[model samples]
Target: MKYVGRFAPSPSGPLHFGSLVAALGSYFQAKSQRGDWLVRMEDLDPPREMPGAAKLILETLEAYHLHWDGEVVYQSHRHELYQQQIEQWLSKQQAYYCQCTRKQIKAAGSYYQGQCRNKNLTADNCSIRIKIDAPVTEFVDLKQGKITLPSAIAAEDFIIKRRDGLFAYNLAVVIDDIEQGVTEVVRGADLIEPTGRQISLYQLLGAKPVQYLHLPLAVTENGAKLSKQNHAQGISLSDPIPTLICAMRFLGFVLPKQIETANIDEILAWGVKHWHLEQLPKATQITTLFSNRIS
Candidate 1:
């Protein structure tokens, strides 16, 4: 089968170096394979989204010459699609309604310990959770190798639709990828922990989950991963090639120091020719030189 990969970015803030790595890595991996590479604007959570961040991200990727094959797919416009599948899950009882809040889950240590599993509650100002059973706990990642989830996370019921009446990332991503017919996922390793949950969701929904490749995360000096939460600086789109090349090098590309100085088109052409998905670091957390070194 032909490869179909995607670069999904949440527009909570401007694209930073860390997210750019995932974007470039996924884009190159797909383009290198002579497959369709798509960009998905993961703008589902409207509350935290920055007004211009989506446009900035597109501009940044365009400046880097990472052109996508089709029109960009925005999550907000696909609410009906999400809702259709969500309703299917709801009808089958594969999902259950939960009334647990943040404090309740945190009191049980962040992970949902399934307090409302037997409540059989109605869906009101209530979130929907998938009932995990006899989990297919272990899966093979192209980068991270065999990953096993803790029994707590593996068997624990997880949120699919939030109480606030919006879909959760796990549910939305699975639905979108399945509907988009994505074959492989190449993204940051920080999301590796959620793979098990995502995989479980797909199975319960009777869809084939894409092959996983979790790229290493970029962390800051304080040893925290780059994010708006960590205050990582936004990637300057004014001249994106060098920084993108450096990011590829950080991921262990052998494209040489010269590629780092090339024009955006030149760098992307070289990167597409030389990119290898296997060389990505397998660790869950990695300190990023680009995060700190970029002035």
Candidate 2:
């Protein structure tokens, strides 16, 4: 099968340094293997999404010369597809409806205890959750090796559709990957916890789950992950080459001295020619020094 990868970003904010690292890593990994790299906008959450953030993300990627394989996909336009899958799961008894609110779930404990598994609540005004009879407790990451989660976590009947009527991230991502024919998922390690749940969803749907390679997450000195919610500064397109070089180095790429001064295309070409996945940090998080860092 042809290798296919993607960089799916939420448009809640612009592309920050952390975002650039993921983009660069996934882009080079796919390009290095002579595969296709696609981009998808995870803009399903409108209340949190910035009005122009999607356009800005595309522009910034172009500025850094991280071009995608085809026209970018917007998740908002694919709601029908998600709804169809949800209905199929509901009819098949693989998913159930629950009226459990956030406060109720929190009152129980840190993780959901599947209180609604046998409730058989109607889906009219309730959330939809997959019935996890045999959860996926482990999966091997392409970079992180074998990863195992608590059996309780694996058995939790996680949400697939919210009470607010929006599709959950896990459900949307799995469907998108399957529909897009994604062969490999190369993103940050912060999302590693959800891999098992997604794998279970794939199995329930009778689709082959794609391979995973999670890159290290960039965090601040205070140990907070660099994110738009944390107000991490966005990437600067005004001086793209240096920022590109910084991301390349963050991924542990050893570049020729001449490549530092090269233009965007040249630097990217060098990256594809010499990219090494084994050199990536194995840890889940890597704190970036605030000073002398990519803007």
Candidate 3:
């Protein structure tokens, strides 16, 4: 089967250095394998999304020479597709509506224990959750190797739709990957925990589960994951080569000393030619230099 990878970024903020690492890693991984690398804007959460962030991300990717294949997909426009599959699951009894609130679930247990499984509740004011009859306990990650989650944790029924009539990230992501025919998922290691849930969704939907490669996460000096919520400075496109080099080094790639002076196209061309998946460290989090730049 042809390899298809994607860089799906939420437009909650501009691409930070941490996100840039993910984008470049996914882009190079696809390009090196002669695979189709696509970009999808995960703009489902409108309240969290920033105006012009999507366009800025695309421009940033282009600036880094990480061009995507085909038209970029925006999740907001695909609500119908998510809703259709969600309805299908509901009709098949694969999913059910829940009236339980977040506080209620937290009080019950660390993970959801299917409180609404037998409720047969109406959809009004209720959230939709899938029944994880047989959860995926383990899966193989290309970089991280074998990953196992406890059955209890894995079997916890997860929400598919929020009470606010918005589609959940897990549901939307799985649906989009299936629809896009994503053969492989190459993203940050922060998402490792969600793989089992997503795999369960793939099985429930009868779609082939895509291969996963979770890259190491870029964290601050204090070990906090660099994220928009953390106020991570956006990647500096003004002088992208240094930033690109920093990402490559963070991924454990060894480049020539003088390569820092190379242009974007030259750097990316070299990156594609010498892409090495094994060079990526298996560690989940690595402190980044960006933390020092914080004023």
Candidate 4:
């Protein structure tokens, strides 16, 4: 099969330095391997989404010369596809309605204890969770080596749809990747925790599992991952070269000094030519003081 990779970002805010690292990392990985790289807008949560954020993200990618193949995909446009999978699992008894509240689960423990699995509950204001009979506790990451999840987390039943009538991240991501024929997932290490659950979802749905390569996360000196929630400053579009070079360096690329003066297309070409997964830092997070200068 041809190698296929994707960079799926939520429309919560503009692309920050951390987001640029992920985009550059994934884009180089795909381009280096002569693979098709796709962009996916994870806009399933309407309440949290910022207006015009998605358009800004695409413009940022273009500014950095990280062009994606084919048309961009928006998760909000595929509700019927998500609902069909939910109904199929519901009919097969592989998944059921969950009426448990956050407090109720917290009282139980850090991980859910399958409280609603046997409830035989209806869909009246209840989230839907899939049963995890055989958990996927570990998987080999292309860059991070072996990754193992706790038994509690691996065996726990996970939500596929929320009570507010929105599809859950795991459900939508797996389904979208499957539909898009994504051979591998190349993104930030912040999403590493959910890989096992996503793999389980692929298995449950009888789809081929995609390989994963989680790039190191860029965090502040205080150890907080640079994210939209933390209001990390967005990358500059007027002068994207500096931020783009910084992102490449963060991903362990050693660019020539002359590349600093190169244009966006030239820099990106150099990145693709020099892309090496083995050179990526194995650490999950890397604290950088340069993050403050991106803006």
Report per-prediction Cα RMSD to one decimal: 2.1, 1.6, 1.7, 1.2
lDDT of 4: 0.90
lDDT of 4 by residue, 1-295 (tens): 7889999999999999898888888898899999999999999999999999999999988877788999999999999999999999999999999999989899889678988889999999899999999999999998778898888889999999999999999999999999999999988888888999999999988888999999899999999999999988888888888888888888898889999898889988988898887879878899987653333
Top TM-score hit: 4
Residue-level lDDT of model 3, residues 177-196, one tens digit each, is 99998999999998988899
Please write out the lDDT profile of model 1 over residues 1-295, one tens digit for every residue: 8899999999888788888888888988898899999999999899989899899889878877888888899999999998887778778877788998999889889888878877889988899988888676789988777988777778878888899888889888988899888999999888877888999888877788899988888887678888866667888767666687678877778876677666778878887898786677656777766743323
lDDT of 1 at 237: 69
Residue 254 in model 4: lDDT: 82
Where is model 1 more than 4 Å wrong at Cα? Answer: 108-110, 291-295
Number of the candidate with higher lDDT, 3 or 4: 4
Give per-residue CA lDDT, model 2, range 88-174, as digits (tens). 888888889998888988898967887888887887789999888889999999888999988878889999989998889999999
Candidate 3: segments with Cα more than 4 A from true spot: 291-295
Task: Highest lDDT: give the candidate number.
Answer: 4
Q: Give me the runs in candidate 2 sitting further than 4 Å from their true place.
A: 290-295
TM-score of 2: 0.96
- Each candidate structure's TM-score, on Cα atoms with residue i matched to residue i, is 0.93, 0.96, 0.96, 0.97
| Candidate 4 ranges beyond 4 A from true positions | 291-295
